[model samples]
Target: MAPAAAAAAQPAPPSLSLPPSQFARLQPHAYLLAHLSPPPSSNQPSIRANGRAPSQFRVTSANTGSLTHTNGSAVVRLGDTTAVCGVRAEILHTEDIASWSVSRPTPASSSPTGNKRRKLTDSTAKLSAESENKEEDGDDESQIQDFSLLVPNLSLSTGCAPGFIPGAPPSALAQSLSHQILTLLHSTRLVRAEDLRIWYQPPNLGPEELERHNENEQMDVDAPQGEVDLEKNKEIKAFWVLYIDIMIISLAGNPFDAAWAAVLAALRDTKLARAWWDVDNEMVVCSDAVSEARKLSLRGLPISSTFCVFEADAASGWRAVVIPDAEEEKELDDSTRKGIQRRWVLADPDGYEEGLSQERICVVVDKEQDGKGKTVIMKLEKNGGWAVDTKELKTLVDISAQRWEDLKQILEQC
Candidate 1:
């Protein structure tokens, strides 16, 4: 939501010189300014008659790992804007162990025509059945923990935002943001893999393992069924996954920051179950020994802040105010259509400012492997291209740096 103070500070806009198509894009912005500068209400967060102060922020809260079935999950609230995240895991399996094993040859094996053929076919069929059962058992062992971490399926639903209809499809923007958040966690190896594993056997010895059982059939001939031998086999590690169903319930503004924050809090509050395999009995046993839940070690928290630059006109008059933070604005009453009328940049801007703004830029900053964080600008096109100059880009970077500093201090106190 736009700050009431910025709205009060802005003047009506002047005549537009641009073509109709250009003018159409600015309409949403006019609506945004109106919303931002709406009559100040007591319900507004940190709000005064003027709307906002330079350092004022909306009310913020964290809902850590709200989903019990999931390995991890979180929801974050910034004023009226909110986002939620959930993490799930699955065990992967493969088919194809038949081609490797060789049948044992013996005098009885090479019997006369009819009996020999029947016996050979029956033996082959039995071997195939045994192999299939073994494969299933292995998968069952692996999936136990994976399912325990997160249910086979989860959905992000309407209660997240106001006026949301149940079973409605998520918007494109919401899907994209969810995908990006999940990708980051997966790519960065954020969660520990061992904590999700239920099997004690080595990775190679499990489903993907290739070897033949001996005549006794206690286990594969080459590899013994014994616990010690299984331990020496190969290993496949398990990792965490977030199945996000992001709904832009209110879309008050600054979605990137909201999404990132929600994801972070969810991960921090996630509880992973601790399990182990009992090799001797060929059974997996989970301890009553659950480890204390721990927060994910975040490299650095990156936040994106948006500012809307509005161009006002003769009819509605020239008017511009930053969406949620309008206090830092200048009335562009006399500026030509080509010049920037009013600049509204600080934190989350309401929808109206978002529509009228010439463009929006998001800054993504993160830590390098060495643990040092750096900021990068992500330009959002209002029409189709980047409109920022080098100097303006630098200014955005500086703003992000300061924002991060403020965020770090707040977190330290937490």
Candidate 2:
């Protein structure tokens, strides 16, 4: 055939045309890379497919006291992901707990201190303080964890995410989220045991009552009514167990952050009424007056920020300029090959970004209200890949610090 005829007979070049949404669903990694690493000749500003910067977080909104029936409730929305948390305070009578007395500290030799039945102050509070001191220090977690005072449960509703069957049991991700929340709760020591304790202070022994008490008491005491053993008389009859329930109404990604934020806001909004053990009724009684209630004094606020690293090769950095260094190309090996790959650190990744990235990092940072108020790292978790190193971790911490400040302001409005 003629040259022109032969050329005409050749097969036509293949071309594909897909809408942006369908392309993202099919080739999420490639789609993201195209936005993040556009060709240099195009002179386009590098941005994520969602029009966000590498470290940009989704819009966040928090609202507390939304559920009037619960003691405390908060609904947090992180972009498309939404989570609601409800904190219910239930009285846990000491009689119900088998190990309640086993862990109780014995009365000290010191003189009995004055007790306040109405307020939180009493000899039992002092004993609790002393008990906390007896610890190695900086570890204020003992009874709260030992007795399981804080109960946190996270549930993902049927429509929250794909593959979450309407009537199926809790998914592994749901279980993992619950574990993470519960772990953070105990690790941070956010709740104070004193806040949960319901104490009972017996009436002081008068001149005649002291003699009668000494005669009936098994242990002989020479001390008179001036300093009766108060620790022995003042007992923790019950505790307020916080049943923190987190429901994921919707999940686009970063469920942990939304869940934790809801937990924090709900706990901050929680208010427990003054409770005491009634000797006549032999049950815990809570005051009806709202003014008598007190908000929980949580520890320093810790905000969690999660980031994922997307690594791409020179060939598919969205087909952008990825010419390897001269030296790298010359000594191309396993190590050098990995070094040539591009990495993009995306913060607050949505469900799409999450599935495309293998390496993940989550930093939990806080600024304590006490003293100079410095930023502290409560937790640093990285897994799935080694793309994130020490320097990357430090950068994540800084990002988390900023996130903490932003969240603090959002929650303050609640």
Candidate 3:
């Protein structure tokens, strides 16, 4: 009896108190879910923990021509993540290339006929491929990748992220980003071959040289119409190589977007100095006058939007009710019984959100001017989870299209 009374008389222990910020850090997924679907009675807005809608992106800013020594430079900031890119132009003389050749390969000979049977076989497709190869040989888009004309390198500073060691070699993430950017540059063909080429016309052509050139042309009379002869009236002299270097000043999240934005901005701002072959000096000479500078004729501006899927683990027992209806509850009874998880799509995710979300999707799009502002998808990449279905993908594309408009405005203003 005395023991029972002592137990009953014990004062009630005080409930533990935890601050919201501390709770947020400890229970990131739960905190985000609460913010995404807030209870109606609380009168809280339906937004992410960072106070952004599911489709809302971070604020963006762009600056160009910041570096004096480089040919062009640009700085881009998306929310807290920032990246700077610098472009340096160098000349590569034609004579310096050891394996350079302008000669077109002759088409393969047909198989020897046996009783006139092989002579009747068709060779149109083979002929077409060989001739197209001959026509687009020298200055096709392949040159950009084959010769490595555009070199892009990305570096993450120690201060940019916590995992980056101070004196360590390039991280796998950095190397992967660099390769992705380079591949995109080549696939987009943003830079024109004509913009990088320098040519010279001889004062006169001798009879022997003219006759030889005429014979070469006569042999290729069956080539495609309107084919651009890379060395039509002038001889190739040199080519400009643009080396793009990107530095991550800060990394909040989505470094790829910021790095690519910086690259695009820098290329648009670039103005290569004019150069010509000096007959007397037998060398390439760059003009000092600013009037001779030329801006790159870039293709349509491509903007990228990234999204992450944040799935709440029902098995972890983290649930906060938000104004549930009886009918809806009954409808989801099977899924609830099955312990199926719920998810949210977060746009322009921050460092905190990135840690919680494993699945990610990035969409690159461009608004075609002549197509009445039609959105053309330049690239699409998604991995890590299967929560994003066709419906979710469509939603992401709409968000990306809107993002393109916003970025286009900022890019032009800069």
Best by lDDT: 2
* TM-score, every prediction: 0.52, 0.83, 0.79
CA lDDT of each prediction against the hidden true structure: 0.47, 0.83, 0.80
Q: Candidate 3 residues 1-414, lDDT tens each? A: 999999999999987977779889888877887777554455455588888898899999999999999999999999999999999999988787655575322223211221133234367556655664555434446666666779999999887878887899998989999999998887777787668877776644555655566665532233321221322445777889999999998999989999999999999999999899999999999999989899998877888889999887766655533325667656765324233236788999998899999999999988888958888888989999888999889889999998988998899999
Number of the predicted model whose TM-score against the real structure is largest: 2
User: How close to the true structure is residue 244 of candidate 2, measured as C-alpha lDDT?
Assistant: 99
Candidate 1 residues lying further than 4 Å off, grouped into runs, are 1-50, 53-57, 65-70, 88-163, 186-234, 237-250, 280-285, 292-299, 306-309, 312-346, 367-385, 409-414
TM-score (C-alpha, index-matched) for candidate 1: 0.52
Clashes of each: 26, 0, 0
Write model 2 residue lDDT over 1-414, tens digit each, in one string: 699999999999877888999988888778887787666556566688778998999999999999999999999999999999999999988888888678775555332332332234588677766764655233337778877889999999988888887779888998999999989988887787878888898887676776677676544245434454455677788889999999999999999999999999999999999888888988888899999999998877989999999877566434534554776466666443433447889999999889889889989988977787799889989899898889878888888888888999999998
Query: What's the residue-level lDDT of 105 in candidate 3?
Result: 22
- 250-283 in candidate 1: lDDT tens per residue? 5565665777666656555555444444457544
RMSD after CA superposition, every candidate: 16.1, 6.7, 8.3
Mark the regions of model 2 whose C-alpha exceeds 4 Å error after superposition: 1-16, 108-140, 211-228, 314-341
Where is model 2 poorest over a 10-residue stretch in terms of lDDT?
A: 110-119
